[model samples]
Target: MELLKKNIHMNRQKSQAVMQVTLEEDFNVPDSKADVGSIIQDEAGVKIEDMKVANGQVMVTGAMEVEVLYVADNKERKVHRLTERLPFEEQINMEGAETGDNVQLKWDIEDLSVSLINSRKLSTRALLTFSAAVEEIYDVSAAVEIHGDGEISSLSKNLDMLQLTVQKKDILRIKDEITLASNKPNIQEVLWKSIQLRGTDIRILDGQLDVKGEFFIFVLYAGDDENGTMQWVETALPFAGTVDCSGCSPSMVDDVELSVASVSLEPRPDYDGEERILALEIVLDLDIKLYEEDKVEILEDVYSPAKELKPVTMQQVYESLVMKNFAKCRSSERVRMENNQPRMLQICHSRGDVKIDDTQVVENGLKVEGAVFADILYITSDDTLPFALMHGVVPFSHVIEVPGIDGTCRYSLKTQLEQLSTTMIDSEELEVKVGINLNALVVRVHKEDCIVDMEEAQLDMKKLAELPGIVGYIVQPGDSLWSIAKQYYTTPDRICRLNNLESEDVQAGNKLIIMKTVEITD
Candidate 1:
């Protein structure tokens, strides 16, 4: 709810008034983390004596039985092809590893492979493990080695679970203190917030405990036991009929207030894989603290798990976004100085460096170096930057697609930039932004959701010459051809194509044309 008050007080020549405002804030923390990696060891011809899953996470639990399906020890620089099948290896070693430990077992496939890759570094033994719950059930079996990693080389795969942890203790204490303070003995497990109680008759009444009033915003506290309803309060839904209550109310008292501060995510490393994090994650570390009178208390303990809200993919954020293709997404903590006046001042734009390497090159044949580009995030507001600030990143890379192939070679790509523009709001002007990204060959088909301006959509022998598609429309009351043209980025003559109108004068019911936007990717 928004509250506004207006008044005028006369001084000698001017009048002024000051108002105070209060707001509520809450903290959010990540509750889970899944990391995948590996652990390697030394051994050979080691068969799977056994395997099992011994952990519980979401849906993991029970005995896990895994078998050694394919294993091989090939040591050759040249590629080998085989169609004929061979018997599997039997009677393998399954000692040393515990019931919960992930183990790798290996065996030689072709005797000739040993000699061919004699000089190569191959893991004589390797282990493969998928995510399994603590109490999961599984079947285990022994089999011969299928593929070889050149020679006796070390290779393994493992998934590690990580629990989120806080980066700042102070922030954690503040958030916890605030949230806990707001939570009060309303009824059972459900707590009522004191700030929501609204009463104009309540200035600081006699005691600072509970405000006296014909309650305005107060919710009636009520609930049904296994039998029937008692005093029902609307704010106690989550704990209604759930928590065992004291069955008695405490003596009426006052002098307490509650509020929320901040929140964060924490992660605890459960496996070696957790050491090296991957692409996606929704975790945080928070610091919270509470204050009363002049005393302060730190509160960082989490009472419950926080569900994932918005899951972001690195691929979409990286490749799909125009920024990461040619240019990498960059971020940094920025500090600035503001004057006493409550207003924003213009500041310099942000600039950073983007390094490109070998992700685009197929092999050692083509190598390109990444270049530095100009970038600036001019946030000219107070405290927080406005979300509407213009932001565009230009990707740069040295084209390596051979010189002779005209357009055939991956030379340079057309620059694409998106922003909430501040200039040219209602003017006919073209602005150009430059950047580079990998562009595929051009393909033109019927535009899917294509934007264009045309005369009409219906097949009319009378005005077939004017209709370019559904890109045109007839002018209506309170409509200008310029706005119609801007909507399609075309001219009145172009609009004349579909509607079949002879002049600029648009009729209220006359049909006008509109163009659809074309789909392009880089």
Candidate 2:
């Protein structure tokens, strides 16, 4: 007897770890730059350089780029930007991790603090969190059919499973330019800029993946006029393209994630040789995972009337997608400035960052709790410091309805800032409106016992001869026709034909007649 088997491809997370570290550095202002008077705005970004795995640990090396916008301490009191790079190295302990294993790392800036140490010196500190996961792909072989003419009686089961089709990492480079409007002034020097991805959508197609999104860019620069006035321009750029992905089709399910890896913005002259075009080169990293649903019939149990068959079975675990949902949460709050802070004359620009603090699984839903950190840049009342920055935190709690959600279900949630705006209510109070989008995917894991192989041997003549040839039986709970036929060393068709039964449906306490038949060999 031979067993026909099928292979199922899958991936599992081998090890995962999360760590937080604080990076601090002190810098002295260069001689070319003026002394630091007061800090107006600060931003920090984390870039990973290299990661090495050995001896069940991952050594990560990276640098944090910090930019500080402050007022000069000289007579001009103008806004000057100071940039620095702080390097960091850390080791994360992950058990069972080996070399050549695929590792994924994600990082976030928890908090950033900048303080004026002296007239010419500054101190900066940033708290960052790094999450690492190692994934391993493998295949499982299951027996689907038995090929032999040995009077074999087998039981089969139909299963709905998900098969992994494509797993890869790719980069999408987007090159575009944003031109200054006719009413806006030409750029002299760009002091600060912010770039963010909004409303991004990714879909799977035949042999490719479609990506569409809009990115918002805000630039604060000094104009080229005689007085060198400071001007700001903001615009949204729409992007649409296709990525070549082999073995991808519309029938497959995709769980692809896209993130801004790095961004480069440079000022270029337009056709008239004026600095009116902002050249943008953005690199987006994508993590792709595609799955195809399959319906399979596999042999669960097997027996032979002419021989002894012992089947080997093992428990296998697989994941099936349950639901995918996209939800939105809207919130508004009023922020009051402190008594010692400067009074706001007019609001210039506003931006926000979302951080998810905790997520809990409730009855048929998920509860998410987080805060939106808003940074507002506005014009001050004083002439010496015309621009000032204010920070506020708006807490939000929302429940996303996910039917059939449970604690055992595995889920992933990604949050982004959809829209943020601020309205000045008074000189000291500002109303902030926030719109957030949440994307969630939930999957359930199943464990099933499957037969992999079987061993066959000759049956004893004495034991075979002692069995009864005919009998009357009463069906009990949890009893099927296949089980009764297997117990009596007969076939289900023979029993049904002798008892004049229409179908194989058997109920408890039902009467049935069974007969045994032996194959005659010449």
Give per-residue CA lDDT, model 1, range 1-522, as digits (tens).
Answer: 111111211101011112111111121111221111111111112122233422311211122111110111222111111111112222222323234432211121111111111222211212322222111112212111112221111112121111111111111121111111123222221111111211111112222212222111111111223422212122211100111112112221111221112112122222443211111111111121111111111111101001111111111000010111222221222222233322324322222223343434333112344443322222234332221122233334454342223321222222212111122211121122333333222111110111111111222233333435345455678776555653443455556665576776775776655653221222
Candidate lDDT values, in order: 0.23, 0.86
The local distance difference test score of model 1 is 0.23
| TM-score for candidate 2, residues paired by index | 0.93
**Clashing pairs counted in every model:** 100, 0
Candidate 2: segments with Cα more than 4 A from true spot: 457-469, 516-522
* lDDT tens digits, residue span 191-293, model 2: 9988888888899989999999988888888888886787888888999888899999999878777888899988999999999998999998888878787
Q: What ranges in model 1 sit over 4 Å off?
A: 1-140, 144-345, 348-361, 364-388, 396-522
